[model samples]
Target: MCIFCKIAKKEIPAKLVLEDDDLVAFHDINAQAPIHVLVIPKQHITGIGEVTDEHVTVLGKLLVAARRIAEDAGLSQSGFRVVVNHGQHAGQTVHHLHVHVLGGRPLAWPPG
Candidate 1:
């Protein structure tokens, strides 16, 4: 199984921040900001390219969860950033579809 699948299965440990039927949010192992969380689907999905109409609900859930995570991390007032690295060229190290929620400091433009 993929690493995220393992995390979702509790086979791998993650600093879980939020979880529900559709997705889970956890702290990024290599945090880029004071509050950097990864929100991923419970089901295994390679990347955004693999997302289909069936994934619409779960995809929306990811954003909703990110918003909640940002609030819980105390970035709600200052605002936060959400990123989805779609492919290898885009710096997606892991194949699983995940959203990066980052905040708690000033983020520069031209992010990679």
Candidate 2:
């Protein structure tokens, strides 16, 4: 199983932030920002395109969840950024699709 799959299954420990039947959010072990959260689908999918219409509702909910997490993390007032690394070259280390909610400081442009 992939590390994220292990995390989803609770076979491995994660500093969980939010969780439900379809998705889970956790603090990245190697956080890039003060409030770096990784929101991932419970049902592992390789990438965004692999997600179907059946996933549309959950994807919407996921975005909502990210906002909620941002508010909970006190980033609502300051604003935040959301990111999804689509494939290997895009910087996705884990096979599971995920959204990254980050904030708590000034972020650079052109996220290279």
Candidate 3:
């Protein structure tokens, strides 16, 4: 199983922010921002490229969880960014589909 799958199954430990039957939000091991978190679906969907109609509900839940996490972390008013890296070129190290929530500082216009 993939590392993210292991996290969801409780085989691996993650700094979880939020969790439900559909998805989970956890702190990124390699944080890119002060308030960085990774929100992912419990079911392994590989990446955004693999998403189908059946994955819509869980995808929505993932985004919602991201927003909730950001608010809980006190980044809602300061603003936050949500990102999804689709492939290797996009900086996706994990195979599982996940959303990145970044905030707690001034973000540049052109993100690298």
Candidate 4:
């Protein structure tokens, strides 16, 4: 099973921020920003290429959850960034679909 699947199943511990029946949000182990959180669907849909219309609800839930987490972390007013790496070429180390909520600083343009 994928690492994220383990996290969703509660077999692997995660610093959870928000969780409901369909999705979960947690702190990133390798935080890129002062406030970096990962929001993922519990269904293990792999990557964006694999997502179908069936995933629309969970996908939207991910963003909604990310927004809530960012606001709770006090980044709503300061602004934040939400990103999804599509594949390995795009810097997606994990196969499972996930959203990165990054903030707590003045983010530069042309993010590399």
Supply the global lDDT for candidate 3.
Answer: 0.92
Please write out the lDDT profile of model 1 over residues 1-112, one tens digit for every residue: 8999899989999999999988988999999999899999999999999999999999999999998888888888899999999888999999999999999999988885
User: What does candidate 3 score on TM?
Assistant: 0.97
Q: Model 3 misses residue 7 by how many Å? A: 0.5
Segments in model 3 whose C-alpha atoms lie over 4 Å from true places = none
Higher-scoring candidate on TM-score, 1 or 2:
1
Collision pairs in model 4: none
Q: What RMSD, rounded to one decimal, does every model reach? A: 0.7, 0.9, 0.7, 0.7
Tell me the deviation in Å of residue 21 in model 3: 0.3
Q: What is the C-alpha lDDT of each candidate?
A: 0.93, 0.91, 0.92, 0.93
lDDT of 4 by residue, 19-76 (tens): 8999888999999999999999999888989999998899889889988998999998
The segments of candidate 4 whose C-alpha lies over 4 angstroms from its true place after superposition are: none
Error of 2 at 20 (Å): 0.9
Tens digit of lDDT per residue, candidate 2, span 1-112? 7788889999999999999999999999899999899999888788796988888988998899999999999998889999999877899888888999999999998897
In model 2, which range of ten residues has the least summed lDDT? 40-49
Deviation of model 3 at 103, angstroms: 0.5
